[model samples]
Target: MSAKSTVDAKIAQGKRTVVFSKSYCPYCRRAKQLLKDANEDFDVYELDEFDEGADWQNALAEKTGQRTVPSIWIGGQFIGGCSDLEAHQRSGKLKQLLA
Candidate 1:
């Protein structure tokens, strides 16, 4: 199956999503905390632990279209970093998305 399909299946199963993060990123920590506070389980992939080569970063950039840490994808949809998440939460869209 495609990666997107796999991600969708995981979300449908009520699994926590994945966040690509880096150390020293407050946004990443906050994003994680928000999920935890909402009682959502999520997995984090530390980009710092992986090779910082162009290929890996490029792949992420292509997916997110931004080089920012804490790039989040939910149900295979690209969700921007912390501020974007907060916006969704404030707008009540996040609850529906999580539901």
Candidate 2:
């Protein structure tokens, strides 16, 4: 899909979603695909350009409380990494959050 369309869908959903990702991370790609498969949308913040500075990682860690790829926030709540997202999908809680 076009990037603009993906972004527009996310905005129209009216739920705050943000993904902090690194370009080379497989988990990040998986997380994005999961959301896409579910027909959900989200904003993504790339950290691939940043150096391994504590400030950058610490900010994410502060928000997520976990230093991992594909840190996802749903409506300002930390839903966790890729595995956690998949678990949420299995449990049907991810839909509830999106709703």
Candidate 3:
């Protein structure tokens, strides 16, 4: 499958939250920790660990218009990055989304 297809497939399969992250990005780490603290089950793909990482990232950028790591999706909807997740959590929308 193409990178874009792979990303779309992952998002469409919303049995769990999806996070496209870089292994070493602090924001990625924090976003993951937030999910963990919320006891949310998530699938995290560390793009930095993949050979096609850049392709995936580029595909994500094209789809979401966000070029940074920790590109997150919940229930097939783009949830954005760490700060965005934080906002959702703060507003209790995260819990609603996880449901």
Best by TM-score: 3
Model 3 bad stretches (over 4 Å): none
Q: Write one digit per residue (lDDT tens) for candidate 1, span 13-90.
A: 544466777777899889888877777667676667755423444566765678787877677677889998888888
Candidate 2 or 1, higher TM-score: 1
Specify the poorest-scoring 10-residue window by lDDT in model 3: 7-16
Say what the RMSD of model 3 is.
0.9
- The true-versus-predicted C-alpha distance at residue 93 of model 3, in Å, is 1.0
The estimated TM-scores of all candidates read: 0.77, 0.75, 0.95
Question: 7-99, model 3: which lDDT tens digit per residue?
Answer: 898888755799999999999999999999999888989998989999999999999999998999998899999999999999999999998
Per candidate, the number of residue pairs that clash is 0, 0, 0
Error of 2 at 88 (Å): 0.3
* Residue pairs with clashing backbones, model 2: none
Superposed on all Cα atoms, the candidates' RMSDs to the truth, in angstroms, are 4.1, 7.5, 0.9
Model 3's TM-score against the true structure:
0.95
- lDDT of candidates 1 onward, in order: 0.70, 0.73, 0.93
In model 3, the clashing pairs are: none
Off by over 4 Å in 1: 1-16, 52-54
Off by over 4 Å in 2: 1-15, 50-54
